[model samples]
Target: MVEDETDQVTLDLEQFEETKKEDTKPTLGDIFTDRVESLMKHRDIDNVLDDQQHILNNLEMMNEKLKFLNLISQSRYEASVTAFRFHMRLLSGVKKDLDSVFRRIRTLKTKLGVQYPEIMAEVQDKYTVHVSDDDDDE
Candidate 1:
């Protein structure tokens, strides 16, 4: 009787483990669907934000280098001109990347509007800059 009870308990434990594994095994279709949703939601936003931040950082660095080049060029003309040209090219590339980032962010915001309206609003509000008309009109 003791042996039979132990066997039954072991069997019950094995069944419980099997059930837990079955519950945890996400179906291929379910996994694919989740991946697609994530791509549409978090991944797209993250990629755009990362790209934008990268370009912004590069542009900032280039601006600093340009300032340094200006100071150095005052002393050394030819080297400074070359450095200025290189920095200008880098600035142009950064601008193009920024344009792409803005376009992607816009598209992502529109796509996520229905499902994540609050998130869309928060992102728009957070990232937007209100321009004040403080300059005198000539």
Candidate 2:
């Protein structure tokens, strides 16, 4: 009777072991395929980063423009004076940029003249007066 009971117990343990394997873990190939799918995405991650940088640059420009509006809103006097002053400042910046560009062109012309004097003979300083630094005194 005892021997028969021991044999039955071993058979039951074997059946349990077979049932346990049905709820198996994922294989290495399954994990590797999932990783490969992520790596093979249609859009690269850099595109998202570039989009964010563009948005930030635009937002920074808008913020600078809005600062003028905020300053004018807080003033007790009429906004025309403040606005005119701001416009003058903006014009001054434009003049400075134009002056720098003119200087750069002059430098480039000089460099070119050193190499080939004949090419710069007709290239006169037409924009020099407009971009003069005298206006900055006011």
Off by over 4 Å in 2: 1-77, 122-138
Window of ten residues with lowest summed lDDT in model 2? 122-131
lDDT (Cα, 0-100) at 20 in candidate 2: 75
Name the top TM-score candidate. 1
* lDDT score at residue 88, model 2, on the 0-100 scale: 100
Candidate 2 lDDT by residue in tens digits, 25-45: 768997898898788764765
Write one digit per residue (lDDT tens) for candidate 1, span 5-119.
9999999999998998788978899899989887687878789999999999999999999999888878788777889999999999998999899999878768899889998
TM-score of 2: 0.33
Global Cα lDDT for candidate 1: 0.89
User: Which residue ranges in model 1 land beyond 4 Å of their true spot?
Assistant: 1-75, 114-129, 134-138
Best by lDDT: 1
Instruction: Report, for every candidate in turn, its global Cα lDDT versus the true structure.
Output: 0.89, 0.81
TM per candidate comes to: 0.34, 0.33
